[model samples]
Target: MRFLYSVAWWLALPLVLGRLWWRGRKEPGYRQHMAERFGFYGVRATNMPLIWVHAVSVGETRAAEPLIDALLRAYPAHGILLTHMTATGRETGRALFGKYGARVVQSFLPYDTGWMVGRFLRHFAPRLCVLMETEVWPNVMAQCARHGVPVVLANARLSQRSLAKARRLSALMMEAARRLTCVAAQTEADAVRIRQLGAPDVQVTGSIKFDVTPPSQMIAQGAMLRARIGPRKVLLCASTREGEETLILDALGGIDLGNSMVVIVPRHPQRFDEVASMIESRGYTLQRRSALGDKVVAPAVQILLGDSMGEMFAYYEACDVAFIGGSLLPLGGQNLIEACAVGKPVLIGPHTFNFSTVSDDAIEAGAARRVNDAQAMIDGACKLLRDDSERMRMGQQALAFARQHRGATARTMALLGPLIR
Candidate 1:
């Protein structure tokens, strides 16, 4: 099976390179990082026992943060080597954990070719490796197995589409799955999927993201922002992507939110300038968060363009209502869990395949509302704004729902004990 998998990968290398090139044409950051990884730039390991972590992007890195903290607490002597596949992920890591530069090292993961994988492993020599979410690279896993490094899948998830693909290539996937020492899945369905792919010790350890508690500073920052906004209705569009912002602005215009403010936070910081241009072209008076300096909200601003990073939770606190982005278009939506965690009245669109289970649960618990289109989103936002009582009620429900979902981190930590030691 391993031989066949390697042979298949060799045969498909050209097609993979072509697809990456096509994607890189539109994503400058992707192109830049691909060059860095392939060129083996800045790839090194400190001389210490290391625990390697692989997270593809910002969301996965955030999801694995609590666990990373836990691991560091448990093994103070061990160092951490974090690898990301995208430039945004690398930037976020530096922003979030750069303070621990002495202990935690961040870099782009090498490509999945056997030579690159061997070089990466030979340098790091990690005691244990943790792969966050659903990033399963056959060559990487096989190399870890060869090196006798215990590999675990932490906070693992397998969407239906992924499961279907895995089933189609069960033999190859099974070989990779067998190389994993253990699988800690987000849901029972995910565990079942891993089992189908021949993971021997698959377990449903729940999602660590639910266990995250917002920092006090973030809470205080939110309070300060609310005081500055001073009774004006604030609609926060968090983690919005391309095309969604235009629709959201159109919806806001329809509602005619007199003096109310709309805050737009694009998912990637690199798109700040692009999003800012779009906001100006739409004829909305804009005040950038960076340019505002000490002022929470600019004095005569109609639109607040969030052009900074690491302050999403604080922004969530400042708003009365939040429209979770990516759902309006078809990007599988950003995590609505953060909004729910903050107990903000939340809204989402129809497309949420990436977080389907959580979205459905939030809607069923009366913690969130799902809008069908741009018009519906405007109507929903207006309705929520007008009815303060209903808004507060949903907010309370959301907080309670998030509180009830807290034990996943503890469960996942317990599952990791045997493997890490």
Candidate 2:
């Protein structure tokens, strides 16, 4: 099965490369580092021991922030080799870790073929591999095991849907899961699922996302942005996926927003223009976030399209109520922890299986409310916007909930410390 999987990957290589090139039309970052995807990098390797971290995209990259910081602090002599799959993740890495200079190196992870991964292992010679969330690749794991690099699946999660999919490829996925030296899961449920997949060492370390301290600068920017937008209440639809935007726009059509403005930040930057077109076609006056450089948002603008990147925290802070996207259409929902961290009232849709535990816990804690559909999401958001007391109560609960979940990084470090040494 492993051999067949590798063969399938080899056969699909052309299509994969073609897709990257095709996607580069919208996100040119895919085109820029073509060589890196094939295990080629420009940076020279150093004698300093490297700790390689694989964060597949923006959310994973952001979630890895606290762990990465902890790693740097714990091992001052070691350097971090942060690898990502998306251009946005790489850009976000630069924005987050550029201050560290040469101490932190960023690169696109090689395609998960044995040869490619082998070349990557040879180049970095990292002592440990930290995979944030669910980034399991059979070839990568096999290559790392062969190269004597211990792999840790940190901040990991597995939904029932994902588990079913993995079980369908169990022969390959099970082998990969067994290659993991340890798994630090977000919840007991996550640990149980990971254990069922054959991870040898699984521990519940809560969510490291709770440990991500919103930067002071981002908070200040949010305040300034809110001021520029005047006194109108802001409803942020954050990290929305492809099809969810259409549902949200349709829902908006039925509601009279009154004094509140909607800010929709799509999950993928490539869809900014596409979503902007959708909003305009719905007859709503829209303002692109990128266009509002030091200018106030006009009151006539009913929708603010958050097209800019690396400013999610600011958007959360600027909004009175937030609806986490991707759930409206069964896309497993994007992270709501960021909004809760900012102490904003959160409204999510029904399909949050990806973050089932956290979402349920949030609702239980009064930090969030789950809606059945887009219309319900809008209704929930509008209600919160209208009721200041209710909104503030939820916001405070969100803050408290976020605070209560802190220390996952420390707990994770405790489990990983011996392995690192």
User: Residue by residue across 289-401, what tens digits does model 1's lDDT show?
Assistant: 88876675655778888888778889999898999999998777778878888999899999887777778888999999999987798788878888999999999999988
Error of 1 at 93 (Å): 1.4
Q: Which residue pairs in candidate 2 have backbone atoms (N, alpha carbon, C) closer than 3 angstroms, thus clashing?
A: none
Residue 286 in model 1: lDDT: 92
**Alpha carbon deviation, residue 288, candidate 2 (Å):** 0.9
Consecutive 10-residue window with the lowest summed lDDT within model 1: 36-45
Instruction: Using TM-score, give the best candidate's number.
Output: 2
On residues 1-421, what C-alpha lDDT tens digit does candidate 2 reach at each position? Answer: 8888888889999999999999999999999979989988766655678899999999999999999999999999988999999999999998998888888988899988899999989988898999999999999999999999999999999999999999999999999999999999999999999999999999999999999999999999999999999999999999999889899988888899899899999989999999999999889999999999999999899999999989999999999999999898878988889999999989999999999999999999999999999888888888889999999999999999999999999998887778774
What's the C-alpha lDDT at position 197 in model 1? 86
Instruction: Point out where model 1 deviates above 4 Å.
Output: 1-36, 39-45, 168-171, 296-299
| Every candidate's lDDT | 0.82, 0.92
